[model samples]
Target: MQRPPRPSAPRRRMPSPGTGLTPLLLAALAFAITALLTLGAYNSARHVAQANLQNTFEYRSRDAHLALVRRMAVYEEVLRGVQGYLRGSVNISRKEFADYFSVLRLDESFPGIEALGIASIIPPGQLERHEQAVRREGYASYTVHPPGPRPVYTSVTHIEPFNGRNLRAFGFDMFSEPVRRAAMEAARDTGQAAVTGKVVLVQESGWDNKPGVLMYLPVYRAGLPAQTVEQRRAAIFGWVYSPFRMNDLMRGLLGEHSGEVELRIYDGAQPGAEDLLYLSPGTAPGRRPMFQRTDVIEMRGRPWTVVFSSTPALEAQRDTVRPLVIGLTGIGVGFLLGVVVWLLASERGRALKLAEKMTLELRQSYIRIEAEQRRMRVILQNAYDAFVASDAKGRITDWNIKATQLFGWTEREALGRPISDLLVPPDQRERHVRGFRRFANCGSGPVMSAPTEVTAQRNDGSLVQVEVAVAALPTPDGYGASAFVRDITPRKEAEERERQRQQRLDETREALQRAQKLEAVGKLTGGVAHDFNNLLHIISANVQLVLRSPNKQQQRLQSILDAVERGSKLSAQLLAFARRQPLHPQVVDTARLIERMDSLLHRAAGEGVELRHTVQPGLWNTLVDPNQLENVLLNLVINARDAIEGRGSITIALSNADLDGDALPDPEMAPGQYVLATVSDTGRGMAPEVMERAFEPFFTTKPEGKGTGLGLSMAHGFVKQSGGHIQLASEVGRGTTVSIYLPRCLREIAEGVMTPGR
Candidate 1:
């Protein structure tokens, strides 16, 4: 019975599932990831915004600096113009200076310029006359006195009558004032612009008590030494000085943005001193300086400082960004939590098992989606074409990096703006919108293919040409459109340049063709003229012998002789035209040659046309066939006269010119000095077709009876044979210019006397 009781019962214990740590671990991880992401995003956004702000400030600062420099350049230009007028040997007077000053006043850019005046170290006698003029004008307040070894007088201040006030301190010695003295001495030493530190003027009887800085630019005579102490070169024309009120200069420089920013301009040489240019009201009057002593010398020599501080409004703007970031972060966390909770609660056991098996796959899918989105964004940003997408209503939905670069606008600034606003000029906006709409519906238009040339408007209101391509994308509710725009101005310009180059090449080829044809004609004409000359000589001898015979009739013989003499003259003309006649070559001074030929050339040109000679005085002597050259001149004049069709001008210019290897028509030609003779005519120019055959024999524009058409052919042959080259340039409705270059004679010719013929 006791053993049976011992085995009575083994108490049954309930099985228990372990407390869930997996869910807790997942929640904790989610929190950690959310916190890390928020912090990283906050830092990245802050850095980007800060960088944008700094870039804007730097751009504005540079603009202000350049504006000041440009203003100074303008002043220098005005002064240079005045100096030019003075150097023209014209008398410099008060009236002339006043007129120049009036011009300066009329310039809107120089708004705050106070005065512009000229001063000079006066000679002893001129000083008295200046003083007398001032006294006679009833300007008792004006005073003049001698200064240094050379007496100098300051003119009566021009501001006196305008301000209705008289200041009698005109005789004040400018050399005694330390600021003015330093500026003057620097000008004398450097022969450049010299500036002085701020100083208060004791002679400011009419002007308010405002300290100013002085600038001086030196003026020296053309031949005088720039810097010297000797009496002969001691004439230091008093400095052309201008005084700028420190406060006014600083205020004007600040412009419309004065309240939005703080500025400080410091003299780097003197640090921790009261020479501050400007300080905003926000800055304490006596607070510790933001800049250290070392910072002052950083910009020494050309010492300047520009301190920029953001306004309270900008600070508030920065402060507002923080709450927005926090709000966005909270929204993100809630969305993530909702997604996880939904997955956990709806299908606890089944989802957990499936998630465990497919975790890696799901993660890979998410990573791929993210990478694709990033790739798309990068492609849009870096593409050279300006990509823009718009909604159905023509409101901009997206803009790419190239759009920003081309239009000077950022994505943030351009988004949600009207697509037509940027792409259409004011005059064509309606038409452009209609065209865009048509393309959207039809899927084809002028700009639908590869990018075609069009103009786009920039943020700064500048127009630039672009090649544009467009596509319409179908959407569930409406249509979206994208445009690809590429800048094509440079390409268009290059194409135009190529077209012009081709045109010039064509013109040159035609000219060469004409010249070749002329050479062939000249050769033919020369042969014919040589034969004709021999025949004419034989006939002349026979006629002379018949005239001396006893059986000859006197009247008949006279008539025959006359006819023979006329025939002889005609033969001579033919020889000249063919360039086959004997020539006497000589070293002729071109200047004298032109002067001597002026009358004859004018006579040949006739009364309707003007013949002018612009022969340079020192024209180099050229060795050429003078008789042939003269014939060449005559032929050119005749051609020019015919081209004129009655009334025009013919200009003959003779000058010395250098022809280098690079300038030669071909490698066979040598480089050296040459005497250039140019014959230019303002006439009814020949067309391209006519010019192409102008030099050919028997290709004359004249009537058959008027000309043999051997003029230019002969001219070209003669010039080439005399060791020279000729070029012809012409344009329809413009004129023609023929240039001949004869090699300069560098050596003296041996003199030879001509003996009597046997």
Candidate 2:
């Protein structure tokens, strides 16, 4: 039995080559390699596309910025020419000044200038000959009109002094007007040119319609000799004053589309703060100022405010390109990867067949790989994003298409260069490298899967947002890592925009809800007021009838009549609060209205508060019921006093505004003009929540007896009924500004004709 067992030992196991488990292992390895290569190729292509797009954007932005700067420089040159004549750096006779202005008008670019004039500060005696010449030549007419309450020096131009247009202005004296005097003082004090705030200036002596702002530049004796700083400057002999129409000036600087941009010029000479020299053609939308200041550095002591603007055009352009690049890169990489895998598989079985077939298959695979590589290179060359690869020791092994595109480096230039030297943000490099090492050791267990957003340095020394996904690769000797990065700047911006939109929606919803609630309260108050009026009338009538009776009953009836009369007055007030009574709207001067109600408002505000009225001179008249206006004033003062809780100040101001089509906040308004009545209070201000509900009927913050809450609601309804708008602005601690804008009358006053009664 033991001898027979020896025969079984001779049966040996056959070795299987390239079959079963071995083939399975080889296939799995090939799949893994193919997957890694495909991913790498795709990422490389993506990097290339992103980099190219970003470069194009940067180049375009720079070009636009430079163009704007050059345009502004041209504007400065034109301004300097005017400045030269004003400062007497260039001697310009009246004829010469007029000629210069005419030439400037011909250019058509400086449309902001309404008219140009030279006013001599030296008294009539000093410049009598010049004035006589002006009159004799018919360039300007000087008339000593009948002496009235105020001395009016009227200068009329038969022919436009500068451009020969028939423009005339009357009743203006160089020495008069506070704003003009201040401008002259500034010119002398600073020994340079000066500009004034929004002012009304006469354009053409006899013409009463044309008005504009004045820019005055002083003229000094050019050859004056001196030793000290003061001695070198000549005395203020005269000034070159230009009538720059506020709207026209803005239009000229911003072109015809001034509505798209906001322009503000700030004068630094004003002591308290910057004075607004100019506001563009239209006021800013959304009730908020768009741009703060666009300053012109003083060229020889003349500070000019050039153009300050907030435009959405540039920002929108910057945000549209990043995603496009990413998409293109992804498509290219996927296509190339499929080709590479197909070629590798096609070559696999041919290695042991015919030698020619093996060689041919190898060549085909090489050709396919090269083509894919070339495609990847082309994509990277065009991309705007930065792409980099590092070896196990953190040395830069590969810098693909996007890396060169974004960082301004080529593969030849960046290969073998330490990635830390160019790609790492200075402050984040150390931390990033540490994290990278951890990821490399752990196969992305800790930080690799985390979608980290970080800033990477570009070739131009700018930082860009990069969304990175990192993974580690293990080889025979060591480990390395690859980062898949996508430029996320546009995405971040999109998210921010969406957030703001949502916020605005929420705010709008809240405002609408508050408005609806207020409307409901108004209906209730109106019903109560109507019923109360009927009751008051009945009681009064019955009391009157009883008073007609004889004896002791008559005396009692008289007492009842007195009580009924008081009750009737109270009902009238309640009706007014409910805005249910008919209003007789007529042209009423807001200044006069405020003056008439001052005493009542003061009394209503009590001893702890001070009531002040700032009525603008030459205030525009508004069409509204005089009684209702007074009631509005009273209600506002009373509310303001209550808001203060004890002591504070209340100010009422009246002003005029030109509301153009682009200036309206609501789309329902028609363009033209308006008059503004403003009431401001220095009190514990209302929060956004409170202010939103302040106009709601019956929504009171005070105890039941203290407020009717219908006051503001009634005011809002009355204003709306009168074809006007009411806006309220308040902060938690910064008090409140309530403005009422009423349409302005289109009536024009005839020259030299007084009103029937005046």
Against the true structure, whose TM-score is highest?
1
- Using all chains and alpha carbons, the TM-scores for the candidates as numbered come to 0.37, 0.31
lDDT of 2 by residue, 1-758 (tens): 45554444566878776556886687677666656665665565445444433443333333323333433333333443354434333334556666555655423544455555555543343234545655676646564222333432322222125434324342135545677767766765554446665465555455443334565655444334322336423444555555665555544332222344455555454322245655544454555422233345442333545444544432232323433433343344335455655434533433244346435644654564475455444433443334456776677766766666556778887777767777888888888678666655644433332335778888888998876544354545456655545678889899999999999999999998898768776766675676467656766776666667555666656666766775665555556545666787767766766666667777888898888878667877677776777777778888888888666888888888887554686687777678888889988888888887787655678886787566887788778777888899998777888898888765544356322211
**Pairs of residues clashing in candidate 1:** none
Question: Pick by lDDT: which candidate is best?
Answer: 1
Candidate 2 has a TM-score of: 0.31
RMSD (Å) per prediction: 26.3, 35.9
Error of 1 at 572 (Å): 90
